[model samples]
Target: MEFQLDKINPTKAIDLYRGMLKPRVIENKMLTLLRQGKISKWFSGIGQEAIAAGVMQNLNNDEYVLPMHRNLGVFTSREIPLYRLFEQWQGKANGFTKGRDRSFHFGTQEYHVVGMISHLGPQLGVADGIALAHKLRNEKKLTAVFTGEGGTSEGDFHEALNVASVWQLPVLFCVENNGYGLSTPTNEQYNCENIADRGVGYGMESHIIDGNNVVEVFTKMKEITESVRENPRPILIEFKTFRRRGHEEASGTKYVPEDLMAYWEKRDPIENYEKALMDADLLTKDDQKKFTDEFNEEIKTHLKKANNAPPIESSIEKELADVYQNFEPKNLPASTETNHIRFVDAISEALKMAMQKNHNLVIMGQDVADYGGVFKITEGFVDEFGKERVRNTPICESAIVSAAMGLSINKMKAVVEMQFGDFVSSGFNPIVNYLAKIHYRWNQNADVVVRMPCGAGVGAGPFHSQTNEAWFTKTPGLKVVYPAFADDAKGLLISAIEDPNPVMFFEHKALYRSQRSDVPTNYYTTELGKANLLKEGSQISLITFGAGVHWALDVLENNPDLSVDLIDLRSLSPLDTEAILSSVRKTGKALILQEDTSFGGVASDISALISKHCFESLDGPVETVTSLPTPVPFAGQLEDQFLAKSRLEKALIDLANY
Candidate 1:
């Protein structure tokens, strides 16, 4: 695409300068605070300020921005309160997240800022989703997602880019090529000479620009933004720049050679941009000084306001905020409404019920419709529901999630299945980004259910036998359900489909054919934030969910002398704390067991919650029994060692000893 300089308004140059200056001030102050120990952590946008300013400058206030950690410049240009930004860094209740999210993770829904600082690559899919929403609504708004060149290596990047290209979404992907990613140089990180070239493979327009040059960055962004607005095609922007500082407060800059640092120092975006303005007769020394003074004063005022603002009285208020909206609670099926059913059959039934009730419901993914899914969970769905609702999609996990987000924003319920959960890494972007944040940001609900078959024991190798449930528990605004029995499989699936939010419905392949329970044939709904207490006792509270719930139940039954209250955590996100506390109160001892690795899993959250709320009531220290931090072995014997049954039994014996 050729640039059209005559069409660009010269007045925007001044607006762009003002926009760029604000972010610079914010970044400097954040660094100052971090150094002084007033803030525990920070991410700098020091050298790459122009790229952030340029992309956001071209976007309207109503447009969306889903940025990575170094997007302070973008938010600053959008006029997010600097003091609130600082407060977020300080971990104060008055911060943007009210201490819920880390400093770099702060974002505002009111400003159309969708995803915040999460792991790289996810926001690209979110930007595509926001753009998809705008396209569906016939709204004229573009979405720009910013990331570093290093993020290109993540599966999410390729997945999101491919979807946006295929969909012709009004999304502009801005990649800040800051020479290096932390300590790793981009040359070693990626094979591509320029990140923009990757877009060519996706058949999208791509642009490469001098990221330090404000004029070049803004002009290039404006051209692409206009093109996207006109035809609703996705664009890739590779902003070539440098990072002046380390990745975070604790990171040392000694990794970079002095020559490389000095060479990039000459290309300082702020200094170069100031010189450009001066040389163009647009801004003089006095004008720059005055702008700086006014900006500093504004920062002081914002800091005061943010500092004095009241603390978030309740951290758990927005805890279940995006779970569902504008949906009335439906009564559960009567206890008599029970019939013996298999897990897979129950899942299919749940989908049928959900589809029949909501016209917005849809089913898609590899072999999901005509092929009836790999495990036949969606068998005969296409014939029954027709093509529009039971769509047979391409074999692309990323595109599936991205398109689901589009359907979700249009108020359609999307049931996307990955032949197996192990393949979900291919589409992790949209799941974490758009699907999770659609409702949280625009207050526009995303009723998308991602049916993933997770866990091992089916002999599916490393590629097919992985459990990534723990990877998503740390993410907010996402509901992850792992059903233990056919009843929960049906009930939770039904509830997940009906709920106006995105849910990761992980059905263990091991249980799909092995387990059977009497599930309700009649329509029923399950609570999104409640735990099920299957058995009650006083010796210890056996806290577990999903396939692990069976092991806990088996332990309780097999060891009659070991009285244990079994709590099944149906929803992992909101995590029915009230029920957990109640169980802990009754049992006076608790043991958290899970099939996922012990490190960074649900067990950690359960232990933390118990310690905070029900500490004094404990009969013994809370116990956790989980798989060791390692990949699931392919061998049956080795797999058995990683299962929760053995671990739960050991934990029970230990709790009884305590």
Candidate 2:
């Protein structure tokens, strides 16, 4: 595209010049502060302001924007006060994250901009989720997201684009190819001549544009945005540009050749745009000087005020207060009529009840649609509720959860089912960083539930079976529930869906069909953070959750002569410490058990907590009975030795003697 100055109105040209200058001046001012050691670090989009101006200028106020670290011009274009930016860098409470997160990592619903987590690929999936939500709700707004050439190397880029294409989502992907990923040249990054070439593989309309020419970007973006608004589709645009400065204010670009730097310097976005506007008489010298002065003065004044802002709080108590969500829920009343159903059937019934109650509820994951999921937990959900709500996602664990995060925040609720509990490792970043902390960081509810089918005992091997509740137990703002009974599975899921928090609901794989009980047919809400006592005794207290609960019950059933109080810990994160301490005090002994490996697992944490709280009540040392630290072996003999009932019985005998 050629530089077409006459195509844009004079008034619009002046606005574009002002928008381009805002980031240029502020970044320049921050560089001086960086050199003085007043600021720690800064990422500048120095020579690529034109692409930002063009892309942002055409966006509808309601559409969502997921910006990269270099897209600070988005904040400027949205009219976010310059003081807030300065306050954020200064770590003040007035910042979007309340001094919690730094740099370009804060967003507000009012601005329709999502604050990005440090990971690049997850946000692309989140953007796709936002676009999906808009489409499902029939909202006219589209979604615009920014990425770099280096980001295209990540798998999430392909995953996000593929899903958006299949769904025909209204998303605009702005890929800014600035020639270098850190110090590595574009030639070393990818084999393709243009980044846009990859878009064809995903079935998207992608194009390469002259990023230095603001008019070109503006015209192309406006046309594409207009068409997307009328008939939604994902579009990928590669803005070929450069960075005059290095990676950051402090990191020198020594790898950049001297000649290449000189070449891009001649085409600086702001400098060239300013001259073009002056030549066309679209912007007067007085207006240009005033705009420059305003940016300069704003930066200097806000920087001083930000420096004088209140210092960060050092209290651990206040910090803890920001960790979990505290909300008043409208609990659904229970029904007395009962029906016999299996554990898997009860979960499906729970989903039906939840979706029927709330129309906005959706279930998303791998093969959950026609395939009915690997466990057949949600086999008929799609036939009941259309495919829009019951989606069969690609084999993208991170994308599924990350997109669910986006969907849940925008007046929609999502239940993401991980195909296997062991696969949660791939999606750990979204679960911990974005989903768990969003509410604590900005007081916004991350209303989503992750249904993790966990535990071993059925010979599903290590990768197919795992009890991952302990891993997420330490994450703040995450609720971990591992239900062992049928009634609790249905009741707790209803409660989890209604509760405005990110909950990791672990359904035991062995219990899905092996356990069947007369669960009530009507909807009910079982309170979270409460323990279930199957049987009461005073000799020794047996504390466990998930498949361990079933094993503990069996141990008690077999040893009728032995006395022990069996406690099923439904919620692992917000542990029922009161019940645990009371039972241990009465019994004067504690035995914690789990199918998890011995090292750094749930059993170890329970042992530590009991030792710290009720040391005087102990007649014998608290023992943690867990499987050996080995991968769940393939051979039946190895698995039998790994999770033998004899081991639990032996530990019981040892505790009884003590």
Superposed on all Cα atoms, the candidates' RMSDs to the truth, in angstroms, are 6.5, 1.6
Q: Which residue runs of candidate 2 sit more than 4 Å off their true CA positions?
A: none
Q: Could you give candidate 2's per-residue lDDT for residues 1-658 as a string of tens digits?
A: 2458878887887778787889989888888888889888899899999988999999977788999889888989998888888888777877877778888987788788887777788888888888889999998889998998988888878888988898888989889999888888899999989989988898899989889889888988989999998899999889999977777766788889999999999988877877777777776789888888988888878877888888866578878777767777667766888888899999999998898999988899899999899999888888889899999988888888888987875678999999998998888888898889887677667889999997777788879867767779878889998888899999999999998899999998889999998898998988889998878998999998877887877777888988998999998877899999999999999999888888998888889989999999899999988887888776778887887344898798799889
352 Cα displacement, candidate 2 (Å): 0.8
Clashing pairs in 1: none
Report model 2's TM-score to 2 decimal places. 0.97
Tens digits of lDDT, candidate 1, 48-150: 8778777787788878777888877767777777776766765666566556567566456567665453566665665665676677567777888788888
- Residue 309 in model 2: lDDT: 80
Candidate 1 least-lDDT 10 residues: 1-10
Model 2 misses residue 201 by how many Å? Answer: 0.9
Candidate 2: lDDT of 128?
A: 83
